[model samples]
Target: MDAAFAEYLDEFTRRDWETLDPDAVADPVRVAVVGLGWFAREWALPGIARSAYTEATVVTDVDAGAVEAVAAERDLTGVTPEELRSGAAADEYDAVYVATPNATHLEYVEAAAAQGKAVLCEKPLEVTPERARELVAACHDAGVPLMVGYRMQTDPAVRRLRDLLDAGVAGDVIHVHATMSQTMLGELGSDTDQWRLDPELSGGCAVMDLGVYPLNTTRFALREDPVRVSGRTRSEHEAFADVDEHASFRLEFPGDVDAFCTVSQNAQHASRLEVTGTDARLILDPAFYEREDRGFAVVRDGTRVDVDFEQVHQIEEEFAYFGHQLLAGEPFHADGEHALTDMRALDGVYESAETGRPVELGD
Candidate 1:
């Protein structure tokens, strides 16, 4: 190989290398999906099908009709949430995936923990930090492994970015700017009665649902937590009256690393995360949504080096990672305690938004 070309290939090894294995495992972990929402039915189910380490063997939902339809179509066992809690199908699966609304996580997790089954709950663990603590404690007490679905941690590009930052490829990080937004009503087919529009179910709105992506991703990449936060929110739509439609917040991490983030449930679709370092800039365009194409690059010294890796379904990677950990008896990176920190940060943001002042989160 040419020396220059060999060095270029080495750059890719340093910047973007495949980290996930997609080959089928000898014994896959059986999962019972607890919710049949669009994301569960669409992305998550398909992702599970593609994963080598996991398989969906059972399903349940509050809506009997939806559950029946999905179970029949996929040839999966359909059970009531009550039956699951009662341990009727306890032997059929090794893990329970809780994808229900934000506030309803505790009951499902408690049920699964009682059955001595592992759990994979979607983020932000629960609507509030208090409930999140309870959920974490439940799994801890049961002596079962608990993983929160922060799928960004499993993305190949994101994993590579974290490695580069750790290697000082971007030098010391100074600041970060991120934004994520989309038209919520249209995405739900304009259903005014959706849970996301409800304050109690969705946990105060756009920031909880959308902004947490950037916030959590930042924490994962930097391996640091924010120590202070300032926030503001507004809602003009009738459907969003009880929740926020738009939100913007500034977070200050230790070492003077600051982040500015904006999110909206009623705006043009956009997502981006830019990290400014002393010697270079790293950008992940179309960062949050798993459905969008991702672009990552580092810019320095009047030159740009784009990192490329095979893009797999990020949710699929998430499931695969969880299953592999359970099968190998390894600990998870996105455990319950890791998610609780984000929940605390989110609670602080809401408080800051309401009080028109900065909120301090002890380091």
Candidate 2:
């Protein structure tokens, strides 16, 4: 390996190195990465590659050129998604990592379950609630572990925020306000992965991609699902004619806990999540993915307490958590059900946005 790549790999795995022990991780699931996209290569796989408890044995991607390049770099063979599911290569790995775009999640998930292979799929689980629930249920019936990759939920800073809430430092989660925005697609639909501009491929714009952080993290922090949701989706720029370029929504929890979020495809970069309670309020600055540093602050009547956690490698935390569940022989945190909950809430958000009315939710 080149020295630069070697250094990068070391840095990637060093932070979360001791998170999992190979010996303690029973049956130690090996991974077959089904997509070699940006997240799969730079963010997800590097951790899997360096993890002691898990190994990536094979990979598959629709982009043949990308897959071939990755295969050569990693010295691993690439297979077709079909081959990964049930062809000659079916039994080669213990789990599958589904990192394809939003729309294609269900297909890979179902295929993985058909072979009784455990899966760790990326966020939005599936673009639609029905498919999300079906995939989760299928994995359940097939007796396979299904985990959705919500990296921010595993963040140390985010975890500390949760701890504070759990400890009642925040009294009760009376309200939460979060906003995530970036201008990655400056030219709008003209950017790479232009497919994302297609509502069919992206599900919805900012809400499906960026808003989901606040949407899911609220549930993670409060440990409660919203009882109702209302939102507005808009295509601010002509460039995003087909898909929403920006979205803002509000979620109402059972206790009247009010959570509001703003996500956009074209905006000055900002990522923040703050939760308010009777006694105090907690804040997470730069709270989502790809942030260089995520910091937390808590404020009481007249006092402010701040915590700056060392950046934890969320991918390692995710893999370690999954491995721990495998060793313990049980479904645990961030399981399929967890993803389903977020999907249900998101479903309502979309409905409310489309109907210009509040959509109620249950369970």
Query: Best candidate, lDDT-wise?
Result: 1
lDDT (0-100) at residue 155 of candidate 2?
A: 69
RMSD per model, one decimal? 2.8, 6.9
Tally clashes: model 1. 0
The digit string of per-residue lDDT tens for model 1 on 188-217 reads 578888888887887878999998899999
Which one wins on TM-score?
1
TM-score of each: 0.94, 0.89
Sliding window of 10 residues with minimal summed lDDT for model 2: 4-13
Give the 10-residue window scoring lowest on summed lDDT in candidate 1: 9-18
Q: So what's the TM-score on candidate 2?
A: 0.89
C-alpha displacement of 245 in model 1, angstroms?
Answer: 0.5
Could you tell me how far off, in angstroms, the CA of residue 163 lies in candidate 1 after the best superposition?
Answer: 1.1
